[model samples]
Structure formats: structure tokens, C-alpha cells
Target chain A: MTKLLEVKDVVAGYGDGPAILNGASIDVQPGKVHCIIGPNGAGKSTLLKAICGMLKVRQGSVMFKGQNLKGKRPDQVLREGICFVPQERALFPKMTVRENLRMGGFSMTDKATLEKRIDEIEERFPILRERRDQHAGTMSGGQQQTLAMARTMILRPEIVMLDEPSLGLAPKIVQEVFDIMKVMTEDGITVLLVEQNALMGLKHADWGVVLDLGRTLFEGPAKEVLTDPRIQELYLGGQKAA
Target chain B: MSDLIQILILGLALGGVYALMGAGLSLVFGVMRIVNLAHPSLIMLGAYVAYWAFRLYGIDPLIILPVAMVILAATGVILYKLVFEREARSAKYSEMTVLLTFAFAMVFEGALATAFTNTQRVTSPAYATDAIFIADIFIPLGQLYAGIVSLVLIAGLALWLKYTRFGYAIRATTQNREAAELLGVNVNFVGLVSFAIGLALAGAAGALVSFVFSFYPSKHWEWIAILMSLVVLGGMGSILGTVVAAYTLSVVAAYVGFFFGATWSTLTFFVALFVVLLVRPQGLFGEKPELA
Candidate 1:
């Protein structure tokens, strides 16, 4: 599989704070679901942010299709075909659902192309069509998540970086979100996911990386990580050897 | 009854002008969370622009309003780029802006005073003292024209914000900056344009003020306080609310002055503001208050 994005020992943090992501690295292959799972504060979200240019990379590099993404603004990163859906339900709440989707295509100035893409998204997510004129904030949590996914999809990004897509979702809704990720990969889109629910992440993702204290603890096939004795013990809640 | 009707018309005309003055201050607060203390100073500068245009070139203040708006809009852009943009990202941005804008107001006041001195100035054209009478009600032509122009400009601003793509981006940024940025909106650029528009509205208001009221450099101090009361009554960041409050306060002030004395007219603004704060801290149209 060819790598679509490569993060080489990236170091980053908030203003003047100690580094949250200390020399962390990952490689995401095209048309694959690459999940990063770790303990809280292990820098999973920060890793995603650094890749998407929301956080400044202090050292190392984020290479997308052989071009370095350092010093690029978030809008510049989006123009380069990378889209980020934040952990929060990042919708313009007061705006109608249709308006929220329109904002997603902000980089595209061509009206025809934007409308065509919106039609495609509406077909895939029928809830968006039903509540097109309703304010986004009035929707339920799961529906908002689906709308957020649909908004990012409108960009037709080469790589979609999702930070905690399943956070705060019910178990069934979590499965539904992962199913959408599966569908995205089937359509030849790369998914870079940071998930806290390790079991579901490992089950759905084709590849997985386990991070601990801002360093990669393990990297392998998702099934193998799911069955690994240490991962099962720490993350999967396997009975500890008493 | 005729006297009451006359007072109502005069009050509404005054309120219309106040709405224009307060609109920019409210918009800047709504989008950027910055309380621009220098807004009235910008209005004063605009008044000077209109004053000179009428004084030197025989041009009507209304005719020269577009020129004043363009000049002040450019000034706003330059000020945002030089001063406010850098501080916007800081943790102490809201607090920093208050002090920074206060300093800007001081500088403008000092410069205007040095150039024009404290002598009161008014722009009086051919129609300055003319009045239109209908059914025992008399309306000064200058106030009538200023009020009509102010309402039309405010309406235009409302339409631009609701219909245009750039306006949509601005509303999105105002609602949530992080969400707008994530969706590829250049939030910094939106801030720059919004500030410029806010200042432009102030300039337009200033032009109207030159004909309706006599003013000096220090007059901004009183105007700022009155404008703040109107904004507070209407709710900060709400243009529609500002308009309603402006009209309401102006009518009340006119009645109070008619019954009691001219001195009590200014006192009515503070009384209304205090009552509104006590009853509904969010103002008439605002949502629940947030940290500034």
C-alpha cells in the first residue's frame, strides 16, 4: 500500500506549554482506515491537530503526497486536500443544515461543482435532505455527527482526519460512525482517526497504532493489536493475572 | 395631542441617528468580543470630514457621506492590521482591547482638539432651518433627511449580512470562530472586514451628526456614553435591538425634556439603562451574557 500521509517524529503543543506530542510518528496509507488509540493525554488528538496544521509542529515534518505541510495555515491545509473534523460537533449551530454544508465547500468558488457535490452528499445522508432548512444545533447528537461527517465529505478531501469521531456517542451510534468510516475507505478515501474506544477502533480499522506517553508503543494489523496480550490487558479489559 | 405627536416625531428622528452611531459599536462587540471605546472618536472624525466638505466645497453633508465612509473604512482596516489583529489571538485579548481603544480615542481627541480647538461647530446648509409641517406637526428638514438616510443604510447593512457569502462567513465567525476556521473560513480576514464595516457605519453616523447637532472634539465623550446606553438597552451585538432601543430612548428623552427640562433628557438614558440591566441583564434582544 502506498502511504498518502507520513508524520515523522512530530513535536507540538499549545502556547509555551510542554510538548503534548513528543516525537510521535505514523504513516497513513491510501484507502485505509488508520486508527490511533492510546490512554488519555497520550497526544492522540494533538497528533491529528499537528497533521492538519491546527497546532504548530515544533520539529520534524508532516508530508502529504511528498510535499511538506509545515508553516501552512489551516485553510492552506484544507486547500491541499486534507480536511479535519474536530472532536466538537463543529457546525455553525444557528445556521441551517444546508448553510453548514455550504461552508464546508468554502474553498471551492465554482457554484456548479459545489451544488453537484452537495447533491451527492445529500443522497448518502438523507437526514441532511430532510432537515436541510433546520438549524444545526436543534439536531440530536448522532444526527449532528452524521452532518459533521457529511460536511467534511463535501470537500472531497484526499485525506479526512477525524479527532474522536465516536466520543460521547452511544454504542450503536459508535458502530454507525465506524461503518461510515468503512464506507469512506471503500470509496478510495484515506481516514486518519484518533479514537479513544480501542475495541471498536481495532475492530473496524485495517491498521492500528498504540501510543503511550507521546511515543508509539506498537504498530501492526488491527486484529493483532486487538488480540495482543498487553493491549487486551490494558485496553480491552482482559482479566489481569492475579 | 398635537404637541405629543410633534414630540414623538422629533424623538424618532433623534433615535434614528443614535441607531446609526450605536450600530457599529454593537457589531464589533458581537463579532470580535471587543468593546471599541474609540468608536465615537471615529464618528467625530467623520463629522469633521463632513464639516470641512460643507464648509470649504459647498457640498451637502449627505452628498459627502460616501467619501467619509470610504476614508474611515480604510482607517479601520489599517488600525486592525496594525493594532488589534496581533492582540486578537492573545488570551487577554478582550481586556487588552479596552485599554488599547481608550488610548486610540485619547489620541484622536487630542489631535482634533489641536487642529479645530474646543469651539463648537455645526454644518448649516440651505435647508438647515427649514421645517415641514403636516397636521400641526413640524419636522426639521435636516433631522428628517438624516433619519431617513440612517434607516436606509442600516437596512442595507442588514441585507448584506444576510444574503452575501462574505456576510455568511462573518456570521459564522461571530457564532463560533473555531468552527468557522475548521470549515476553511479565513477568520482573520473576516475580523478585518467586520471591523472596517463597523468603522464605516460610525463615519456615516458622524456625517449625519454634523448637520443635526453642534459638536466639538470633546462632544464625543457625551455621545459615547449615550451610544453605550442605547447599545445596552438594545443588547450588545444585536443591530435590530439597537434600532428599537435608539428610537425608544429618543422618544422618552424628548418627552422628559418637554415636561421637566432639557437637563433631564440626558438623565433619562442612564435611568433606562440601569432599569434594563436590573430587569434583564442580557438587554432586550441579547442572549445570556458571556465573559467579555
Candidate 2:
């Protein structure tokens, strides 16, 4: 299959430090929901950083469509139709919600397209629309996450990467966020979600990656990885096989 | 009644200068968490530039005003892109800026001393000696013009911030730099331009104040102290608060000076800052939430 994004033997790290991502490989085909779940410090965030061009890749190649993605700035990667929604503090606190959406269109020169995206996003995400005039900081945690998701969608990115999206949220809000992510994938945008809660992620994610200490220990369909006894022993605190 | 009226006029005029000057330095700190000690030095440089341009080319100080502002604006951008930008990558940027600009302030002062020497310099343009009288109140023509222009500029800045797209980006950056970047706002470019505009405010004020006051290199410390008090008393980065604090401090100073002497005037600013800090350590109109 012609992959939309291919991470072929990618190795990356912070500073002159040892590579946190040691020769990891993954692929995200168009309109596929690929979820990566791993234990603590498995370099989930680091891997996401590498994909978004925040951290320099020490080895191997990252291909976006047919083009090689190396040495590209975060903003450049964004214009290349790759949007990243960070785990926390997604919205600019002091600015109004409408102001935050305008920033999403910074790379788009077409004013009509930008405004139309804003209107569409606000409609799709009612919380953002209701509070468009309100300062983003005053919003609740769940609201902020929803706004963050809405912001990336404004760009109409080829792949939207979310890092620990359910972090620090109530179970109900978590469900709400995941439901939105499901709808997003329905719009034909590939989603790479790094979720620490393996059960929920494996259930919702179409594909599963088991990254242990920054190296992929298992890669297969979500159902098989979730049911695999080995994954249950390590990730699920040695629970009995399903 | 006449004395009270004159005191209000003089106090408000002096306060206008303080508001304009302090706004620039406070803005840099509010957004970047930087304490730019070189701001006062740069303002001095702006003053000197205006002085020279007018004295040599007979260019009206008003006409040369934008030139001085532009020169300082470019300098501010370079200063950020080179030093402050790198330092700002980490949380410790604000703390490091103190020493960095402290050294920079010394370098600027030394340069000024070598060029202008220790001799006193004054911009005694014809307007500097002019005065006006209305009703029972007497006003210096230069002070009246300065006050009016200061109000206009402050209003223009407020409008730009409230209504413009650039203002939205600046506010976003100040709120959260990383989030602003994630949204696709060019944080680096915004930071550079923001720094330049902040410095330009100080430059414009310095040009206006040159007509009213005399200067020496040592005056940098004195002005820095006054600006710190103004910024601290107002709430860092609160534009309206700065204007109010400036006028309040200047009025108190003028009244105290009129009753006592010129020396007693400077003391009022300290007293005001001290009393205000007791109530709100963050200053009046402080931010609702801590950014850093």
C-alpha cells in the first residue's frame, strides 16, 4: 500500500543525549486511525515530536507522502499538512477563542478559506463556537482539549497527531474526546494518537503499536495486540489473559 | 486654586512622559519575562540622536522623531534575534536577561560617555521656553504639546492592540508561547517585531522629553528607577494601569515638591510603590493568572 506517511528506521533524541527513539518504524496510511500505546517513558511524546519536526531525527527517514520530511521546522511541517495537538495547555490562555482559531489559519493566505474553516470548525465543535468571544484560559480542561482538537481540524491536515489527549480528564470527558476523534477519522483524516490507557486506545484504535523503551515490541491489528497475552502481562499489570 | 490647577497641568504632563516610557519596558517584560536594563540606555541614545539631527541638519525635532524611533526599533529587533531569542528558549530566560542587559546598559553608558563626554547636554529648542495661560491655570507650551501628543500615541497603541490582527498574535504569544506556535503563529517573528515596537515607544517618549529636561549618562539610573516604580506600581503590562500610575505618582511628586522642594518629589514615587505593594504584591491590575 502507498503509505501517506512512512517512518522508516527513525532515531531521535534530545540534545546530545542517547536516542530515546531507537530505530523505530511505523506507517500511517491515509484515513487510517493508528494508535500508539506504550508504558511510561516509552518515548511516545518523543516520537510525536520527531514526527512534527520539533526534534531532529538522528537517523533514518520520515516521508510525508512522496516527499522526505527532514530538517523541517514545526511551522513548516504544519504547512506540509501535518498538525500536532499537544497533551496539555492546547489553547492560548489570554486570547479569546476566536483569536486562537485565526492563528490556526496563519499559513493559509486565502481569507475566505480560512474564515470558512473557522465557521465549519465552530459548527462541528459547539463548545468553541459558544465561547468564541471568551478568553480561552477561563475555559474548563475538557473545553480546552476540544478547542485544541478543533484548531488542528481547521488546518485540514493530512494526519492529526494527538499526544496523551485524555490526560488529566474525567472518564466522561475522555469518552467525549475519543468520540470526537472517531468522527475526525470518519472525515478521512489519519489520526496518530499516543494514549497511555492501553485498553481504551486498543479498543478504539484501528492499529496498535507496542513500544517498550522506545523500540517497537509488537505491531499488528488492534484486536490481536489487545488480546495478546504478552502485552497483557506487561502493560495491563500482569492481568490474566483475556 | 490657581496653584492647584498649575500643579495638575504640570503633573499630568510629566506623567505622560513616564507612561509612554515605562510602557515599552513593561511590555517587553510582560510578554518575554525579560528585564531590559538597556531600555533606559537606549532611550538616552534616542535623545542624543534627536539632539544631533536637530542641531546639525536643523531638522525639526518633530520631523526627526520618527527617524529616532525607527533607529531604536531596528536595534531592538537585532537585540532580540541575537541575544534574548536564544536565552528565551528556556524558563530561566527572565533571570538571565537581568545580567545580560546590566552589562549591555554599562556598555551603552560607556559609549555615551566617550561620545558625548561628562558635560551636561540640553535640548533648549524655542518651544522649551514657551508657556501658556488659560482661566487661572498656567501651562508650559512644551508641556501641553507633549501631554497632548502622549495621550494620542497611547490611544493609538491601545487601538492597535485592541482591534488589529497583530495585536491578537502578540496577546497570544504573551499568554502561552508554545500554544501560540502550535496554532501556527510565527512566535519568533512576532517576538522580534514586538520587541522592536516596545523599544520604539521608549524612543518616541525620549525624544519628546528631551525638550523639557537636561541629561547626563548618570541620569540613566535615575530614570530606570522611576520607570521600575511606574511599571511595578501599575501592574506589569497593564497599559491603563501604567497611565494611571504615572499620573498619580507625578501628581503626588509635583504637589510634594511644590509644598516642600524638588528633592522631596522623587521620594513620593518610592512611597507610592511601597504602599501599593503592601496591598497587592503583584501590583494593581495584575494578571489574573501567572503565565510562567
Candidate 3:
């Protein structure tokens, strides 16, 4: 019911480059899925980076549980219960699926706590437990996406930020992944999903925000944003929002 | 029989040093995706450090091995921060690392030559000559020590990479640098430490082998042939592969020396490498090649 994280007018970019995210803000509530959909180069991934401290926050603030997330590193943000999965295939190819999961909990020290968390994660993503000994790279693209999600869940975070989890996946596998996202939301894990696949993302999401050229163009209920013609014109390439 | 066994012992000991040197090369290539050509020079520099330790403090070459590793590790970190890191990140990739390390090696070789004469230096302590005989096999005590130390250090490094936090970070980055950074890994920090750790292994190898063999300024060029062969035969970037390759080469060289002539032993080593490469270009334990 309460706000878990607040990205208030956050401005950020890489190196000494120009700000890619300008005056962007979003609030994620507990047990909510906030999907950000936009065309490529719209600062969607950059927004996720700003929240997780991968990029420098040059203006405004990111508050997680009332703690300023501005200069904290990605691991520290993860320690504070926020885990991020980038748009890239982030799994370590040489390591087994189980090893990758344990790697997600690298910052976690307590053995019992890690074991308990792994038990919980493996239960949700049965594929991970089924192929625990399999190398992450050996799995199918869709399966690798599932394993990546399971890897983050091992961290036992309050929020999981995903950047285009459905990219490079088959239509059927994409549906399966969306089902996993739904399950994640039902389990009370807040998700901030950045997607280019708009319709499916909106249907699976509780809330939706459309970003365009480094700024928030629209925000509201998923259905409402889906019906917004301007959003459809911009992101759907002038096609009707399916 | 006695002559053959002595040759085998000598070959194995030398192979252990080759493995150590190859391990460092493999680590740098594995983690940073760069071939460090000057790694041999770093090894030479390490030998100098050991030579100094023995001459000045009378510390045994065995004792100086770890100390030289630490010093070389520091030097490696500084070099990575200064040259290799930025260049490797550029569009040039491995070529930049090769050029930088080659330059560094030249400087390293020049400095070593300047610091001491180019003549060979043999470091020996009071017990360096002691040997143990089991059945008909004779093993020089120093050679045995170097071999054991090499194995132990390699095992220690392997265990450290498997179990430690920094090890996980290194492994993660080696898998995917950009993604690892997104997960909050300090890529720069990991790169620095990995570079240092990799070079330190080379340094230790240099010190150990210098004690066993006569050390000279340009011996790195000689070792490069064997070292590169071991790496290519084992699969570059695989530490375990390097060990396996090293021993394989050692056995081949020993037998060649025993059966044919000692002069052709090095040629035999190169031949074995070529055969292996023809069969498996990726090396014996190489990772599956991704689409470049």
C-alpha cells in the first residue's frame, strides 16, 4: 500500500556524457508491477540504471524505503532489497545454473539465509532446480531468461527491476515469461519492468508509464495507458495499441 | 634407466614452472580478454627480484618467490590502470593489450639488463643442491620444492577463484563485463586485482624457474615459445588447461631428450603443440567459441 521507491525527477547518464534521463519520476508501490514502455533510445534502461545506481544521479533523488539511493552502487542497492536484470543476457556462461544463483547472493553472507532463499526461488522457477547443474549458456534463450529471473530471486529482494525480459524470446516462451512475472507480482515482489513489447507488458502489469526521448510522456493504470492514442502513435509505430 | 629417470625429473620440474607461467597468461586472457605478451618479461623481472633478495638478504630463492609475486602484482595493477585497461576497452581490444604489454616487456627487459648484467645468474642456497632418491629415481630437493610450490599455488589460486567473493566477481565479469557492472560489480577494481593476481603468478613462476635454471635478460623470448605453446595447447584462458598442457609438453620433451637427442627436445615440444593445435585449435580445454 505504501510507496517502496520514489524516483523524483531523476536525471542521469554514463561517463561525462549528456543526461539521457531528464526530469523523469516514477513511484513503485509494494506488490505492484510498473512497466515502462517506449521506443528504443527512450532512456528506459537508463531509468532502471539510475534507480539501481549503475548511472550517476545528477539531479533530483531516488529514495528507497526513505533511504537516498543516489551514490550507492548496484550491489548496495541490491543489498537494500532491489535487484536488477538488464536487457542483456547477463548469466555467466561457464558457471552452472545453481552457481549463477549462488552468485546472485554473493553479497549475502549467512549460509542458512542463502539456503532458505534458494529453496524459495527454486520452488517458484522449477526449471532452475531441474537444470541446476546445467550451464546457464546451455539453456534455450527463453529458459535462460527464466534462469536470470531465478538468479535475482535468490537475492531475496523486495523489488526486481527487469529490462525487456521478453526480448529475443519466442511468442510462446514470452507468454510463459509473462506468467512468471505475474507470479512474481502475486508473491509481493515489486517489479519495475522496462519493455519495448508494449501490449503484453501492459496486460501483465498493474501500472504503466510511457517514456519518450528521456522524459515521461504518460503514466496511469495499464489499461488506461494502453488506450492512450498518443502513446499508441509514438510506441506502436502509428498502429493501433493491440 | 638412471639417466632416463633423471631427465624425467628435470623435465617435470621445468614443466611445473611452464605451467605456472602459463597460468598467469591464461588468467589475464580469461578475465580481461587480452593476450599479455610481456608476461614473460614480468617473469624475468620477478627473477631479478629473487636474485636481489638472495644476494642482499641471503633469503633463499624459495622464500623470495612470494615476495616477488606481491611486488609484481603491484606493478601489474599500476600497469593495468595506466595502459591495458583503457586500451582493452577500446575498439582495438586484444591488439592494444598485446602492444602495451610488448612495450612494457621491452622496458622491463631493458631495466633488468641495466640493473644487473645480461650474464646468467644462478641463485642457490645451502640446501639447493640436496637431492632425494627413491628406488632408482633421483630428485633434486630444490626442483621438488619448486614443483610442489607450483602445484600448491595453482591449487590455492583455483580454490580462491571458486570460493572467494572477489573470485565470484572476477568470474562474473569474465562472463559478461557490462552485465556484471549492471549488477554492481566494480569492473575497474576487479580488473586491477585480476591483472595483479595474474602477473603475480607469472612473477612467482619466474623466481622459481630462475633458481632452477640459469637466468639471463632475454630468456623470456625463449620461454615465450614454450609458454605460448603450453597456453595454446591447453587452451588460452584456462588455468587447468595450462597445467595439463605444461605437463604434457614436459613429458614429451623429457622422452624426446631421452630417446633422440637433447638438442631436438625443444623442436619436439613445438611439434607436439602443432599436432594438438591441428586437432583442436581452441586448445584441449578451451571454451566454446562464441560468434565474434
| RMSD of each candidate relative to the true structure | 2.5, 2.6, 3.3
DockQ each: 0.70, 0.53, 0.47
Model 1, A128-148: lDDT tens digits are: 999999999899888889889
What DockQ does candidate 2 score?
A: 0.53
Give the runs in model 3 whose Cα sits over 4 Å from its true position.
A1-3, A8-25, A56-72, A237-242, B1-10, B77-93, B126-137, B256-264, B267-281
Per-model i-RMS: 0.9, 1.6, 1.9
Between candidates 2 and 3, which one is better according to lDDT?
3
lDDT of 2 by residue, B211-273 (tens): 867887767888887888888888877777788889989998999999999999998888777
Q: What TM-score does model 3 score on chain A?
A: 0.94
lDDT of 3 by residue, B1-292 (tens): 7887788788888778788888999888888877888889888888888888898898888888889999999999888887776765565688777776778778878888888879989788765688888888878887888888999999999899888778888888887876676565777788888999998998898788777778888788877788888988888788888999898788779888778888888886688678877888888888656678
lDDT of 2 at A53: 81
Tens-digit per-residue lDDT, B1-292, candidate 1: 9999999999999989999999999889888878899999999999999999999999999999999999999999999999999878788888899899989999999999999998999999877789999978999999999999999999999898887789888888887788788878888899999999999999999999999999999888898788888888898788888999999999999999999999999999999888988998788888776588
Off by over 4 Å in 2: A16-18, A238-242, B237-241, B272-279, B288-292
Report the poorest 10 consecutive residues by lDDT, candidate 3 chain B. B83-92
> Considering every candidate listed, which one attains the maximal DockQ?
1
Q: Runs in model 1 with CA error above 4 Å? A: A239-242, B289-292
